[model samples]
Target: MSEIISDLNTIDKESIRIAKKYKQKNKNAAGSKEGTFTKIAFISISLIFVVLMLVVPLISVVINSLKLGLAFYIESITTEYVISAIRITLLATVIAVIVNTFFGIVASWAITRFNFKGKQILTTLIDIPFSVSPVIAGLSYIMTFGRMGWATPILDTINEALGTDIQIAFAVPGVVLATIFVTFPFVSRELIPVLNAVGTDEEQAAALMGAGGLTIFRRITFPHIKWALLYGIILCTARALGEFGAVNALSKTRGGTFTLPLEIDALYLSGSADSITASFAVSSILVIISVIVLILRNIVEYKVKK
Candidate 1:
């Protein structure tokens, strides 16, 4: 009897343990199902949002651009004013990219490799373009370089000395200046984090081995930041290409200083159906360029990751 009782007790304990384990497994399965449902719901919402906001608008632009015909689209984009705007846009973008790239590299090097007074101030100054409005920037430039402005005397003296018709406000130079101001911080901002993450160990080692500054940078620093620099250049190019507000404030002459964005605005504001259609056609060009830039950016990002 005692042996039987002991065996019965052992069987009951085993049954209870298995029941608890089975119940716990069922609870886990239910939790997992709920979690999966939540994930799928979030992903679905994101896809819907992207399709509505981005894909639809892009598709609309393409369709409207071709709504008339390919010849109309071609004619619109090839007109003298449109061609001039394209040229100016490309010129501004090229200059901005070059200037910002050089400045970004130097700024990143100085900020990362050394310690000095006003370091924080310099960093903040670089970011001013981001915090301030582009319209405000353009107005400020006008006030500084306009005829009645304080810098007027200096500009007049320089033009007299150079014996050339050089102008800043309400000219091509002013447009380029505005583009540069807006896009200047992009490259530097992209580089700062990369340089910080890379640290200064290898640069210091190269210097200790008797490498001069340029040699150290070329051999040691350049390799680490090349991808980052390329990424920054692409970003700066894209931003400069589409800059409108600042350029608009400074550009007074259509077909002379107008960029692509400004040209599009001019077409739209003409208050004619044909002009509106032409505006969309020109906008498609920008859309295509932007898509190309987006693709390039993704490629650079992939390269950096690899």
Candidate 2:
């Protein structure tokens, strides 16, 4: 028992000695790292700028939204025009998100899984909306579907033959189409890296194990990319809800087409503080929805990481 006690004492002393040596070494290394200090300083300053850019405007929006009285805010929300604007924007945002989610998933699959002629060109083409001006994007639709458009005659013939009218660049279809165009790349862009990380080997292995394509997708591919896919869709939906230029131009804004942005613009034109406050009331609703969606996104990511 005495010998065992002596052995433990020796081991404890040796461990303490090693720990002291390691601490000295780490302290010396940290003291020598001027470059590391500079890097941390730079990163801190850059982060300050980033926070200022992102958070300041959001704070301003919230403050402005609260400038009105409670009754005024309630009345603004209850107005029929404001209610319609909210509904239309919500409807367009939801439909656009649904459509874009499918496009992104399928396009990502096609782009990564297949090789075809003009594949590179087609990939570049997907980014056309990002490069082109939003106003021009809207104009292109107008020029294709308006009375003076080339397709107008084709549409006229179809209308004559079928006795049914189809409006492509107006109303709900126009809003949804414009949104889909703007948001098409998000899901594809997100899923590409995830799919690439997963590699093709898993899918191939699953296939060899007698798993069908859909089964492989469900059991293997979906789990891998689901988080990124959802993140991209949330971002796309947010952008779609706030879209102004493309929607307004394509919609013509003549026959009962008033999205939230358009409605806000109309309020500004009226030159009344109350109208602008009404607009802010509507904007506040969007801000709330965006905040909730972003929160949900973070929660999803946390669950995924865990």
Candidate 3:
């Protein structure tokens, strides 16, 4: 009887142990499944947001542009005003890139390679355009160069002295200057951190070896920041192409002075279906240009990493 009782107790204890172990395993499996589901749900939400915001708008634009067929697009793009707009945009982009690139390099070098008073102030001023409204920028330019501007008389006197009808307001030079003001920070902003990260070690060593200023820059610094500089130029080009506010304020909106953005607006406001289609066509061109810039930027970044 005693042996049987002991055997029964042992069986009961073993069964309890097995049951507890099974419960623990089931709980762990349930927890793991819940975590996996949560992860999937988060990813799904993110993908949906991207599709709605970015992909949908882009697809809509492309489809609208193509609704009238390829020939129509070509026709609209080649219109006289459209051609002039493209020319103006391209010219401004080129000038902005050149001016900003030169100054960006010099300013970035000065900030990174040397220490001086008012350095912080200089940096703050350089970044002002990013914070300031483009409309305000346009107004400031107008206030300086417009008919009632303080400098208008001075400019007029100079023009008379030079025997030229040089006009800054409502002209190509004004457009170029506005573009430059907005894009002033691109290259310098891109290069500053790179210059800081690269530090002055290699530069100092080269200097110790009696490398001249230009030589050191040519061989050492330029190679380090060339890709970043290119990236900045690409950004500046994109911004210049799409700049509307400042250009609108200063431009006369004539065939000779209008930019692509202004031309698009004019087409849209004509209240004719055909003109609207033409506007879409022109807008499609800008979109294509933006895509091209993005591709080039990626290529440059890849090269930089290599």
Candidate 4:
């Protein structure tokens, strides 16, 4: 009992000494009053610059959208083609987010929880989408799936065998594929650091108790990264919603493959004042969706901090 008491006293003394040293270090590192003023001024200028460039444009879009009145905005979005495009965009976003979320979990888990050959290469491959151009991604799909594409023979054989004619390029499926490629990295990248920080201590202990892989993941891992997962999902959804270059490269531009962004571009290019108004209305919708995503992101961040 005395030894335990003595040990506790020693620990308390060591903690106090470390705390004092930390305080002294910070005190020495703190800048002078003029330097503090300069820092504050720099931060304020940056904030103002961001607000002017980014916030003002969004506000302008909203204002112009409302200028035509709520009725025009309503009629614009309610048009058949516009509605179809919105539906297509939503579908692509949903599918991409779901597919990427699953991939993110599996890929991040493999990268973080295991040591393997080519681990660095695997991580680099996962990040390729981030640096690759979306246009290139779209063209790659076209080259692989188009009528004269490399896989054309395989696709033709399958169709012939099944007596079914399947179209991929210039189709909804192609748009989804492009979206998936562009958004491949968001969720997994977001979760990697989180999983690394969390480490495998609890999972190892759970395994020692004979827990299965899925059981450990569900009850142990998922809860730790749920917020990060949600954050990544929101970011992926935003990117998918805004994806234009890749989808445009593969889309037929009319019939059924047009997404909301494509429709907006078409409307703007039509050169009619009403079409321009409609474009603004659609832009406003996208802006609103983006704002909602930002809000959800903040909520997730707050929860994660807690």
Query: Candidate 4 — which pairs collide?
Result: none
Return whichever of 2 and 3 wins on lDDT: 3
The residue-by-residue lDDT of candidate 4 on 104-181, one tens digit each, is 999999999999999999999999998988899999999999966999899889999999988788989999999999
lDDT of 2 by residue, 21-125 (tens): 999999989877976898999999999998899877777766776678778878876777777777777888888888878888888888877678897887888
**How does model 3 fare in lDDT?**
0.90
Q: Write the per-residue lDDT of candidate 3 for residues 170-250, one digit (tens) a residue.
A: 888888888888888988999999899999999999999999999999999999998998888998889988998888888
Model 2 ranges with Cα > 4 A deviation: 1-52, 300-306
Q: If ranked by lDDT, best first, what sequence of candidates would result?
A: 1, 4, 3, 2
Query: Relative to the true structure, how large is the alpha-carbon lDDT of every model?
Result: 0.93, 0.80, 0.90, 0.92
* lDDT of candidate model 4 versus the reference: 0.92
Could you tell which candidate, 1 or 3, scores higher by TM-score? Answer: 1
Top model number, TM-score: 1
Q: What are the RMSDs of all candidates, in order?
A: 2.1, 6.6, 4.8, 8.7
Per-model TM values vs. the true structure: 0.94, 0.81, 0.88, 0.86
Candidate 1 lDDT tens digits, 1-306: 999999999999999999999999999999999999999999999999999999999989899888889999999999999999999999999999999999999999999889999999999999999999999989989999977679988988998999978889899989989999999899888888888999999889989889999999898889988999999999999999999999999997889999999999999999898888899999999999999999999999999777
What residue runs in model 4 are displaced by over 4 Å at the alpha carbon?
A: 1-40
Ranking by TM-score: 1, 3, 4, 2
RMSD of 2: 6.6
lDDT at 238, model 3: 94
1 or 4, greater by lDDT: 1
The candidate 3 region of ten consecutive residues with least summed lDDT is 58-67
